[model samples]
Target chain A: MQYDFEEILETIKMTEIEHFDIRTVTLGISLRDCVDRNIEVTKQKIYDKILKYGKNHVKYASQIERQYGIKIANKRVSITPASIPFDSFKLDEFVEVARVLDKAAAEIGIDYLAGYSALVQKGMTNGERELIKSIPIALSETQRVCSSINVASTKAGINMDAVLMMSDVIKETAERTKDKDSIGCAKLVVFCNVPEDNPFVAGAFHGVSEPEVVLNVGISGPGVVLDAIKSAGKIDLQQLAEVIKKTVFKITRAGELIGREVASKHGIPFGIVDISLAPTPAPGDSIGDILKAMGVEDVGAPGTTAALAMLNDSVKKAGLMASSSVGGMSGAFIPVSEDQAMIDAVERGNLSLEKLEAMTSVCSVGLDMIAIPGDTPSTTIAGIIADECAIGIINDKTTSARLIPAYGKKLGDYIDYGGLLGKAPIMDVRNLSSNNFVGRGGRIPAPVRSLTN
Target chain B: MFISYFGKLKGKKVKLSESEIRAIAMQAINELGDNANPELVKEVVEKAIKNSEYVPIPETQSQTTGRVILTSFGLNHPGIVSNVTKVLSDANCDITDLSQKLMGDFYTMIIMLDISNSPKDLSEIQNDLNVVAEKMKIKVYLQHEDLFRFMHRV
Candidate 1:
């Protein structure tokens, strides 16, 4: 039979797809081995561990990137919770470790450093309690160190008892560092069965079960999927979904290939693939395209709920179908500055923190890259993070918040974090409000409803 | 035939719109099959009508439906249609079943899909699959008869 081969070719050509590559492969290294009776020996061991393990990480990551045609964006390290070594009176050990990690990160070309953290759930351990008391002085001395204090968990239920104490700890930490610009307060998170292989920070403490040397891949592909979905116009909803599924499959294949090769070359086991839609203030690839595709003119409008639900569903379905092993908060992100569309939405008065919270309900990570007023109280910021984490705990999904309270910046003002933090316009907060409820520092007890299950 | 409606012949001329003329042609065509030729075509024409505003109704007739054949190589790297059709021909499976999707090293193909009359179960047809798979070092999985239909609902 005679046939139109060209028309058939055109149909196959319609499947246009691309990927943004995995942005970061963070290795969570515990610094417990760095402790010693002698102060200088402790500092040297910290330096030695970072220098030894981090030496070949970036080199091997680059080689894998070239072989698989996938870009490996950042190769960094997050150590064991730094609060353990801070049980001293002077806080000297904390500053020493921070300086060592900063130097090691610079030498290895890793952009981010994390794991300056404290855990105070159900009540702080003696070491943890002391570390929490000295957060302000230690944070001020470190150049690149970022920290977090876990004050609650779903498994252990609400630690309202501990959270109440944490309120004062957070307040004192926030106040003591008022004069220092670099020392920012990001010390609040809720861990709901935290993963050992999670590479994203500032909550990336080396979990107990994880290996000393394992390759954790953080895959980012929002731009590629958004582009394909945008091109599939006038199609039925089911057909649109199929196109997205195919796109995600192809992108994930690229990530898996790269991850396996990275693991092989480094002689480290291949970790999980985090199929998250991480953004970087770039044009065309922003999460806003997804919202717009869902028929929302502005991202944070009343229709935002339906819009985000559709976006997250498609992303999760496509990612799951694409790869066998998927981990991390593998969903579409709505960070304000990291995404260009989100940044523009906030500046244009089309997006607000409340609307963002509504959108984050459907996203993997909650309230990420949000910039609130500098004068915003630590309790209020903690409350925002708490609300976001509560959604994660209840839903049994991974969620986190990374809010930047730009010092000396008020409502309508903007701060440029220059590179990866991008730049964000200060968003308005609810006025005439006191977080007196939050200030009554103690963990909110986990819901009694969960006990039945 | 100068037939006209009795009340409509009030002035100098009477005219039918293009649609009305086409309607007459269509009626003649339907009544006489393909034999309605030049004379029927001429009778359908009328003089220009006022405004001549008319919406033409589309012809309603049954036409042949198009078919898509999904063909797969299953196990080996065969030259598209030639080798895939050869397998069907050998099995006497006819051209009814076909879809080809190359996932990784595995060459999978499904044929439009009427295999009910075949003398073999799907497993029997998949026996010679080893020969192709060993040649390519890839396993071939088959979805025969009602399997594809049962699988993809959307």
Candidate 2:
């Protein structure tokens, strides 16, 4: 195809000015066939498949990044949820398998490999139970491995049992890595209706239904969108949304092009384009910056949810228009720790944990990368997850909570994840107890679409 | 017939901007029908060269081999280019292209370098570049070509 000179220049300008980047190129490798009665055999199979499929993925990603003059920010590997592959393994064996995944990822220079995960939305299988139990040690001991648990879905209703269990797991994970300000909690995510082919961590895992190997791309362009909004200067809400949609179309188109090329190069089927406006710690690249550009002085002010709802829908609309294979969690990500502006807002008391939770109902993921007080009860954590999950269940949307109980750190303290994870201000959580509410642990029952809330 | 062809393309199959397609169309028209005198061409070329130091007209698209684009962002200051390029030249890396512009106080410069013949890997060279960036109180991003293509174009 003939290249457009202006478009080429526009790209150079975007890269130079805006922090536009292909956020991640994640290769989802399925390990369903790795299951064996002998856990050792299963572990070997997992390692062998990862090494075989992942050896040249990062090498190719780097080469392509250079060849195109675009930044491929991260190269990752997502495997089928480990729980499904080792239903017979004990807790320590699950830890051992997580070690194998972690070691293989490090060997291949993968930024993060996600799969120390389980799907227990309805109820927990023995395998899922063991994996959930093993998560505290598995995540605390590993460097590059991320774990996610799905405990609720619209179709299957809310799994209150799994929600309570995952809440306890989060606390355990925080306590085990307390010295590093609960860094392990940062790597662990609890989800409701998680996307099967998401490329972003710490919620990415190859779904049971996905192909054996697939390449999924997550495109990030919050800075680009925010720049567009700023240049258009105080337009009506409709026009503002139009600006976001057009910008996202351009971003998603670029993502589709790169994703297909990468997939073709690897001889693997291409998966969806997750057009999430993922932010870094850079000055201009922030979701809070985008919100402020939309005239919200504070990110979590009263109209924030409405603004977020519009932003999220506009992103999805443009993404679908730009790519035929748009899926995953394609919306505005409001992860508190990753966004510098959000962290600033929280520190200044303009944003709070409750507001963040409310915003998640309208955005992509749920209460993400939020650091609550060290003394916050595990039941409170479960209560928060249950609330987010209830929202996801009713709306038939994906929601997640990656709350870090900055162990021994209070609301005023900050935990520095460093690099892309950014710094998180420990925001105050409501002291209202929900232990009895979560204690009635069954399912929250499916939403009645006929009776909309 | 040629005019009609373009007219139909306006409503139907033309994906490129009219100007871009027009450039190609004009070139085709000249190549297919026009005749030019070699003597006149040579005389004009020689006259232009005699008037100034011989600067070769680069091909429409410059060929790139193992090119890395490094962008430096910071408050505008003197000698930014000279100092940064000095580092590259000292490392024996060839600067294939350089462009810079100032918008307000922020000076952004993009340098495209040929690193195929470099003695050190890009990562090691980035460390050296980082030192210069740190000293200048600027952030320098070294990126590959895909970043530009994947961000800007479909």
lDDT per residue as tens, model 2, A107-224 = 8998799978998888889988999999999999999999999999988999998988988999989999998889999899999999999999889999999998999999998989
lDDT of each: 0.61, 0.83
Model 1 lDDT per residue over A185-244, tens place: 443334443455666655566654667766666777777777777778778767877876
Output the worst ten-in-a-row residue range by lDDT, candidate 1 chain A. Answer: A8-17
TM-score of chain B of 2: 0.55
Scored against the true structure, residue A423 in model 2 reaches a CA lDDT of: 92
TM-score of chain B of each: 0.37, 0.55
Residue-by-residue lDDT tens digits, candidate 1, B88-141: 567666564344556686554444534445675444555554465555554333
Candidate 2 error regions (>4 Å): A1-6, B1-154
